[model samples]
Target chain A: MASALRVLGVDPGLTRCGVGVIDVAPNRAASLVHVGVVRSSPDLPIERRLKAIAEGIRAVLDEHRPHVVAVERVFAQNNRHSVMGTAQASGIALLLAAEHGVPAHTHTPSEVKAAISGYGSADKRQVQTMVARVLRLDALPQPADAADALALALCHAWRSGGTATGGGAVTSLTPAQRAWADAEKLARR
Target chain B: MASALRVLGVDPGLTRCGVGVIDVAPNRAASLVHVGVVRSSPDLPIERRLKAIAEGIRAVLDEHRPHVVAVERVFAQNNRHSVMGTAQASGIALLLAAEHGVPAHTHTPSEVKAAISGYGSADKRQVQTMVARVLRLDALPQPADAADALALALCHAWRSGGTATGGGAVTSLTPAQRAWADAEKLARR
Candidate 1:
């Protein structure tokens, strides 16, 4: 039997960085390993704030030692004020993943939503609900960022075919094609 | 006489990251210590590209041991395709500064131009010419990125009053006021 694949997901932000780790079995069963947010005050200097974020993420990476990392893909078309910070935070996450010898991948918000809820346009509440159901958690993940992180982790697992099935074939699909494929996967299950 | 203040300047970009080191005496006279660009091919994975940038900057920091770091502040309003990479690269520079126990500051393009040429609207050629003149270099700094990096270092020195006159007061001036003040400084010299 193939072993479970562990994934670390990051929804990067300067003020509130959300991170989650989960294990996905070959049969597609998912279980949470850890979930939390790293917060830095807006009042701190930019360097100091980024340092705090680096330390927080480092601690998580050291403890979890996940097989792969999944980060939310930020776009320039997003909120102009926060986009720069978001991109910076994501960079730190990606750099840390490389330093730890873990391969990192970025999934767009729509890809995450589609992977978790079978709909790219799903709302936050819907995505949260789906994450809870998928993980068999007693409650919905609080703070949309954390849920987003978990959703990202799940998206990576499912999109990569849970590693158990040798997920390489899934990487070639277009975004639209991937989304529908994910939706169909959910229907079959 | 106060000791010369050393600054490491970075014009952050994924493809061609510019780095320069300069020594500024209290009298606001600037001398170039080193200048170069770190290139990363876009064909590589994003993580590999970032790692190459990080190693390049880290090597420069280790070699020069500058007193401070200055990076060009990226804006979301800039070229959309490249702004994200620029911000990410800047993030690595700033984070490395913090890790190395050096202070880091960011200046916009206009700020660098005004500090170098006493005009916020100065073109690249004008700013490059001024930098070459100030540094008493035999020739122009090749590659616009390298020139921009040297300009940023000089800007940091001048804007911070070059550490000889105690630059705390300059931080309070508006952009227009600072540009005019810089112009006056050049006129008097």
Candidate 2:
């Protein structure tokens, strides 16, 4: 059996950022490693709130040392205010992943739901139940955001068909993946 | 006359981020220091593009050592795709400011236009012309984003009523300014 791949998934937000870590075996079984939320007060200034979020994420990276980082993709929506905050938080997640040399990917909400529950339009309750069952958790993870994060990690692991060995061993690469790798190399230059 | 305060303004974007630096005198006279755009190819992956932008901004910070950093505040608008990218870039600007210990501020587009042109609803040409005239430049800055960036820096300097020496020196503090300062302190803690 290929070694388990550790994935860190982030559900980015300004007030409460959800983070979950999981180890996925090659056979597609997933086990929970860590799950929590990073909270920042809305009373704070924008930059200060962002700083706290970045620091919180950095601390998580230091503690868990996940092989890969997965973030939820922000889409255009009617709630501009909410979307802007989500995008900002998502940027911090991607930046931290790059700073730590971890490969980062983004999965849409629907993609995550489909991957975990086999239904793109699965409701929140359905996703939560499925995530719990997949990870063998005795009960659903509190906070819908935490369950969403775990789903993101699982989606990326299954889609990529690769194990993230903290040491940076990628098992397979498609042309697009090769392009991403080349682009990352150029960015570091 | 007190020493001039150097300010770096950013009009954040994913594909083309506008950056401008200026030195504002105690008497409110402004002179341009640097103005340019950081371009990242759309063909690159999002993380790679973000990494390029962060590196580009870091290089600017290293070279300029500006007293403060100013970013154009993003507003909710139609076109969710564009807004998301702007917010992401804005987040990077704030994070970089904190990482380098430089105070960061945000100014709205109307605020910038009013400060530079005395008209909140000024047209693009009006803003470009006013920015050139204020800096005593012989010609208008190319690429409207660059000129907008210069306007953002000038707006913050005029509104803040103080220099950003990182020493908390200010002529006066409004309730909002005080709140921002307190939040920044808490973030640094």
Candidate 3:
């Protein structure tokens, strides 16, 4: 709460990792601090690809110093291949957050779509249009993945944070869920 | 030794994993190359992504790199994501040869696909045709994931590097999946 919050939304991709950071200043507008994609071709070796993704994101996190990270949650789209790859990339994004001690939250595709486009079933084009409008970008973002990831971050800002989030982070959790998680942790032993 | 060895193939993706590998050489090629997929998606949370995928593949033995560790038998696919967010990273790749001082292998997707396809199935479009032509690829190269993984490495010359496997100096088996693993070991003793 003391520190200014910056939200970085990532549309995780195995081949193309899209990262966008928005700086939210108190009583002011959210500025687009960073946006880009970590591009890796499917033709390269897996090891090299992973390093690039990790390093690329690490740079964004370190450079932007975002308070929390918001990522596009992985939704099962029946396309097994797409789902699996997205999950892996998402995992890496979480790892980046965890490693950095930054809390990372995942938003479902529908939820993300709804927040940005006001329609869960909104196609990629529609989501992009709204993201551009919300961010007040002069032109539509390039590489749909990048724009989508940025939009996810923007959605997080709308729902939470200083002016948003309704109440402090304490009320952020339901007592029941918190108790269940504590019990689950004890059970792991 | 005359019989072809077991090989496991791996196809890494966001959700629909395609694994198939078989042992095949100039002559000896047999047995099943384990194949299946783990699904993960944008719908799932970051933690679930790890849970769903089992976070990619791991093996029981250095059985893959049948030859030397210097050259990996199977080249990792160049899915840009694999490089940045690999399930295991260098520590995991060290598996085949790292512990025992043996070597791990690396292979490109095309090489592995070619081993199954007379020609390389370099693109996704070619995968179906190549998958259809699998007569010569499986000597003991197990699943498509295993086979593909090994094909990349074995393509380099299983004949010369026949000693690339157990004979290497690397302590191959990981503690996570070591030959002596048991419940007691995991009990924090």
Best by lDDT: 1
Whichever of 2 and 3 has more DockQ, that candidate is 2
Better of 1 and 2 by lDDT: 1
Would you list the clashing residue pairs of candidate 2?
none
lDDT of 1 at A65: 90
Considering DockQ, where higher is better, how would the candidates rank from best to worst? Answer: 1, 2, 3
Clashing pairs in 1: none
lDDT of 3 by residue, B40-150 (tens): 674754445444444343332333443232222222233444432243222233332333344444555555444333345455434433333333332333334433443
All DockQ scores: 0.71, 0.50, 0.08
TM, chain A, every candidate: 0.87, 0.84, 0.79
- Listed for each candidate, the true contacts retained, as a fraction, are 0.67, 0.65, 0.07
lDDT by residue (tens digit), candidate 2, A35-93: 98887899876777888899988998999998999999987664656777788899999
| Cα lDDT tens digits for candidate 2, B1-189 | 248888999999998899999888766677889998887889876777888889988888999888899998886674646777788989999888888888898888877766666657879898787677777788899888888888788777766654783343464764234433432333343
- Model 3 chain B lDDT-worst window of ten: B175-184
lDDT by residue for model 1 (B79-181), tens: 6688888999999899999999888899999989887787799899988888887788888998999999999998888777765222544567764466456
How high is the DockQ of candidate 1?
0.71
